[model samples]
Structures are given as structure tokens and as C-alpha cells.
Target: MSEENKKGKNDQFGELVKSMNQFFHDKPVKGFLQTMDEFFRAPFPFQSAFPVEVRESKDEHIITAQLPGVKREQIQLDILDNYVTITVQSHELFTEEDDHQRPVRRRQSMQRSSRTIPLPQPIAENKVKASYQNGLLQIRVPKQKGKKILIEGND
Candidate 1:
């Protein structure tokens, strides 16, 4: 190609690259891509490893989580102040043995997933209750109990 044509082609390629970079770095596009990246990177998209649902009532908060393919022994629950954390851990074992009863190519892997939720009101840790059944976890956190004290000077 002639020098002029070569220069022109190089300029056009550079412009294309600049425009693509600008489009990808734009605020809206970057934000959307970040959101999508997080969703896709999670073990379970939108579920954040597992689905969690919290329901609030006048006195207590009810929290439920879906943990399909998980066992009761693999689940853990923790409560501190007004926050609830649920963690699930599992281990996988693989072994390829020959007929001679010797082990070859043995591998063990561990996986853990967790989620933390904040409650609207202070919880009564002693009064909190949890249960796991059929790969489902339910936690009830009761609001802290307090005696009523009247304030007269402010009125």
C-alpha cells in the first residue's frame, strides 16, 4: 500500500479502538457490566449462592434460605447484635483406585458459601431460634424487649 493509504488505514483503526474504549468505559455501560459480572461470577446468579428471604412483623423477623443439594451438617448459623449470617460448607472426595486396593489420583475439595443480613431492630440473641429441614433454613429473631419509660420534661 502507498504511504498515504497506510496512514489513512492506521488512523481509521486507531479511531475504532478509541471509540470502543470510550463506549466500554462510559459510566452507564461500566455500571451495567459490573452488575452483570457480579451476577455471573456468583455460584448462583441472582441467588448469591443461595436465596434468602426476610420477613418482618410487629415483634419478630423471620428469615428463610434455600440450600438445595446441601446437608444439615453443612449448614451454620450465626447471630450478632442485629445481623444474621448463614454459612454452608461442603467437601467433595474423589479417588481412583486400581484392583490391587491401591489408591491413585485422590483429591479432596471444599466449598463454602455465606450471606449476611441486617435486621431492622435489635435482636434478642437468647430468644432467637433456628431450624433446618429439607434443605431449607428458617430463623426467627425476636425484637429486644424493653420496659416503657415516660418522658415528661420534653412535652
Candidate 2:
């Protein structure tokens, strides 16, 4: 075989390996591996991002978030200036006993996640109400009323 043909074969092999690496690191395969690791590594906490929506009404601003597997007590909401922050903290504990009545395996995991959203306008922080039910967190805050300004145009 000629030297050029050997070089071409080597380059092709390198390109193939690079493409395979890229494919494995891409979203689909990487996400599956992360999910499986989270399931098997009970001693390690896994944090995942959820979805949130903010809506505006005539009188109030409503914020909704989906938080499956999260308890109401694990969630915390805070409003500062025009920004609202949501935080969730969770802990799981598991233990297994042996035939001799001694503890064999014990696992504990703690996870925390937080998200912050800025409102389009200021709100009445003191009047904010929040509720969590059916794995959904909803927050309602009254919008602050702004004074109207009138401008006169010269003819």
C-alpha cells in the first residue's frame, strides 16, 4: 500500500472515533446515563431543573412551578425588589438490616435547587401569597399601582 493510502485510512479512523465520542456526549445518551446514575447512586443526591411560568393579570402577578417529588416544606419563596426566588431542599434516608439485627447498609442524600425570576413590574411584597398542592407551586402578588403622568403638547 502507498503511504498516502495509509494516511487516508488513519484520518478516516480518527474522524470515526471523534464522531462516536460526540454522539455519546450529546444530549440523548448523556441524559440517559445521568438518569441511570441518579437511580443507582442512592447515597448521592441528584438535582434536576423543573419548569416555571409567570403570568400577569389586571390585579396581580401569578407564578407557577412544577415540582414533582418535592414536599411543601422543602420549598422556600422569597421576593426582593423586583426579583422572586424559589428554592427547594430535600433529603432522603434509607437503611438495611442484616440477619444478626445489625445495620448493614445506610444511605442518606440531600439535594437543593433554586431559581430566580424577575417581574416585569414591582409588586406588593407584603401581600404575596404562595401555595403548594398536587406537585405545583403557585404564587400570587398584587401589582403596585403607579401614578399616571399626563403630558401637554404645545400647538
Candidate 3:
């Protein structure tokens, strides 16, 4: 082909690549892939994000979880009957600098992680308590008691 034709074809190919990139970046599918990418990039996709342990006593159940680099306000704990759910939302700030030592782009990203665990016995929601110290989160839930039934003796 002629040089003019080659140049035109190259320009068209460049435009096509740019359009594809933009489409991929602005699509909801990209958002989903990004979410999955974030999940897979965590310390351990299945466990390390919020490693939790449950211990049960005669009167109560104790739960402990480790959340490194997270703030106390970022943690939310929910108790529903015998199940305990914990959610943590964290934010990270990223800055891109130019050669002149000036920031060219700045962005803040948020990640949310949640885990639900079942207790050995049903718990009393009114008596549940939770506390966070350092990077450790601890929760105490009082076990629900069943009332004994009294039966009348027949003659």
C-alpha cells in the first residue's frame, strides 16, 4: 500500500485502541473486576481479611478478631440471634507525583470486608457487648436461657 494509506490505517488502529481502553475503564464490568481484584489482593482472600475465632462458655460466647491498620470507627458488629456478623470499612489514599515533585493525581479508595459466624448457642441480644483496643476487636454475647416447663400431675 501507499504511505498515505498506511498512515491512515495506523491512525484508525490507534483510535480503536483508545476507544477500547475507555470502554473498559468506564464499564460496570470493570468495576466488578476491580472489586474482585481488590478481594484477591488481600492478605488471604478467604481468611486473612478478617481472621476470627469464637469461644463459648456456659454463660456467654466470646469472639475475637484481628484488624490491622484499621480504625475502631471503621468496624461494625451485628448480632442477630445466634449469628454474629462483623464488617470493616477501610480507606487508603494514593498520590501520583510528577517529575517536578508535584502531585499529578490523588485518589482515595475504600474497601469493605464482612464475615459472619454462628455461635454454639443462641445469644441474648440485649446483653451483648463489644470493645476494640489497639487492632483487636472482642465481643461478648450472653447465652439465652430456656425456661423450664411445669406440668400438672393428674389424679
Candidate 4:
């Protein structure tokens, strides 16, 4: 090919690359690609699960996590005054039975969920109570009762 033709082709290629880069830089496609990359390289997203609630009262702090269709034995909880972590894992197996001569196909799936919560102050370890019912995990963490600061009348 002629030198002028080669130079023109190179210029066109460079301009195409620049325009593509500019378009992706100004859009969410880059973020989508990043997520896809992470999903392929890792087992789960860093923040996949967000179904949890924390409630506090004078007596104790309660943390409830919604984990429907998960077995009781698959849930774990660790409690501390400064932080609490919960992890839930489930595995399901599906099977098809054939009486005479058909082939049976089975599929197994696994799901894992985890969450971390931070508390204002440390609580007693022995005072923690946890329960799981109806696919809901509930934890009651009793805070170390703090001394009340009585405010005197203004001078």
C-alpha cells in the first residue's frame, strides 16, 4: 500500500479508538464491565446481601436478618460490642426419578450471605441471645448499661 494510504488508515484507527474510549468514559458501561470482571474473578460480590435490620432499646440491641429458604444449621452469628458479623450458607439439591429407563438429571445450587454491623460501645458476650425462625435470624445483644448523667438545674 502507498505511504499516504497507510498513514490515513492509521489515523482513522486512532480516531476510532479515541472516540470509543471517550464514549465509555462518559457512561456506565465501564462500571458494568468492572462488575463483570469482578464477578468472574471472585465467588461473590463484596456487598451482595443487604437484607438486615438493627433495633435498639433500653434493654438491648436486636439484629434481624431476612434469610428465607435457608436452613437453621446453615446460619452463623458472631457478636461483640463493637461489631457483629453474620454468615448464612445454603445448599439445595434437585433430583428427578425415572422408574423404567429414562435418565434423571440433578442440579445442585449453593448460596452464601454475610453481613457486618458496628455497635457504638462494647457489650457483654455472655448476654447475647440468637434465634432463627421462619427463615429469619434474630439476635438480641444486651449492651452494658451505661451510667446515667444527671443534669442539674441551670444556674
Point to the candidate with the largest TM-score: 2
Question: Tens digit of lDDT per residue, candidate 4, span 20-95?
Answer: 9987876367756765675589754333584999999988889998877677898777776589999877676856
- Top lDDT prediction, candidate number: 2
After superposing all C-alphas onto the true structure, candidate 4 shows an RMSD in angstroms of: 11.0
lDDT of 3 at 98: 80
In model 3, the Cα lDDT at residue 25 comes to 89
In candidate 2, what are the lDDT values of residues 2-48, reduced to their tens digit?
A: 99999999999999999999998997798667657867886334355
List the candidate 2 regions with Cα displacement exceeding 4 Å: 1-47
lDDT of each: 0.82, 0.84, 0.81, 0.80
lDDT of 1 by residue, 20-75 (tens): 99999997788678667855686442233688999988888899999877888988
Model 4 clash pairs are 81-123
TM-score of 1: 0.61
Clashes of each: 0, 0, 0, 1
Ten-residue region with minimum lDDT total, candidate 2? 41-50
- State how far residue 105 of model 2 sits from its true place (Å): 2.9
**Reference-based lDDT, residue 6, model 2:** 100
Q: Which segments of model 4 are wrong by more than 4 Å? A: 1-47, 93-108, 147-155
Where model 3 places Cα greater than 4 Å from the true spot, the runs are 1-48, 120-122, 150-155
TM-score of 3: 0.62
